[model samples]
Target: MKRYYQQEEDIGLFQRMQQDDPLAFEEIYNRYFLKLSNTAFKRLQDREMTEEIVQELFVNLWLKRHRLPELKQPESYLQTLLRNSVIDWFRARARQDGFAAEMLAQPDRQIVNATEQHILYADLQQAYESTIGQLPDKCRQVYALHQQGRSVADIADQLQIAPKTVESHLLKAHQTLRHVLKDYSAVAVALFNFVF
Candidate 1:
């Protein structure tokens, strides 16, 4: 009985949100923020990152509110978004740690010889730099900033470029890197896909 009432209430909130009601958006955020935060924190284990992820989730919800009316269950939709965001965070962390570590950190590497891994790592490093060198000036700068953990918005502000422009630069960098890196190492290319 209570669940039915809650569903009805959620539907009402979504309807209002679809109509650009800030109060409805706030109500949804207030209702789910704690629940979503708890779930994200359990998966992330870092309070700051959990908070950032949940906050981004709400920001995105508000940004995409017009589509809320199409959702059958806002809670389920939010949960899925949170899950994907957590996975993306993990992938980004892995990328920042270095491609050699990403590729060779697995248990399977233990079965392979260290000398081979060292050669592979050196080759990958060379190819990575060479590929990066191929990027245009501004695109390279944006990619470098991103590699340094700067957010797209931050990079845009720092570079005095639009966010979409920053994203375009990033996408170009990733495509160029992925394409060139694939010829050198498929594993590197696979890990490289996380940039998106």
Candidate 2:
């Protein structure tokens, strides 16, 4: 069995590497590390990642030495490994950048949404309060009772008014409020449906 190797035209070094010869592995690493780094740097154009890929390859070569026997074309095999590693690094970086972009934009959308909701609610409350105060006393009473989930018949019975009168009061209240809140009609109508 091949137990040691020198770098001169020797398939013996690969066989020795399969037998876990540290000397043969050292020679191979020293011979190829610079070439691998250069190849990777040229493709990736990033210093830190190029160094990392080369180091990982050497570390993997040591750990998976038993598999080295299958590598008849050592130079081609090393290039293939480096090429695949660069592709993987690029894909990972793209996904990370997309996620970071979303995260960066998220706060802006949330702030705008919250501010709009606050302003809309404020406008709706002001219109509702001011218009209700302008309502005739009977109409304001009917509208308040209707918003509190009371049936028209129940409100009429409690207020000693006819059911038809109660409905008329509610209709007048809706029309007057809609007119008073013309500028905020769309938003107020949305909220009004939930209330009355």
Best by lDDT: 1
Best by TM-score: 1
TM-score of 2: 0.46
What are the runs in model 2 whose C-alpha is more than 4 Å off?
A: 1-4, 99-196
Total clashing residue pairs per candidate? 0, 0
Candidate 2, pairs of clashing residues? none
**Candidate 1, residue 21: CA error in Å?**
0.3
Instruction: Score residue 34 of candidate 1 by CA lDDT.
Output: 96
Predicted candidate 1 versus true structure: per-residue lDDT over 1-196, tens digit per residue: 4343345577788887778877777778878899889877866679999999999989988887766548666676777788788778876876687845646677566456456757776777788888788789999999988876576898999999999999999989877876777665444443333322
* TM-score, one value per model: 0.48, 0.46
Residue 186 of model 1 has an lDDT of: 46
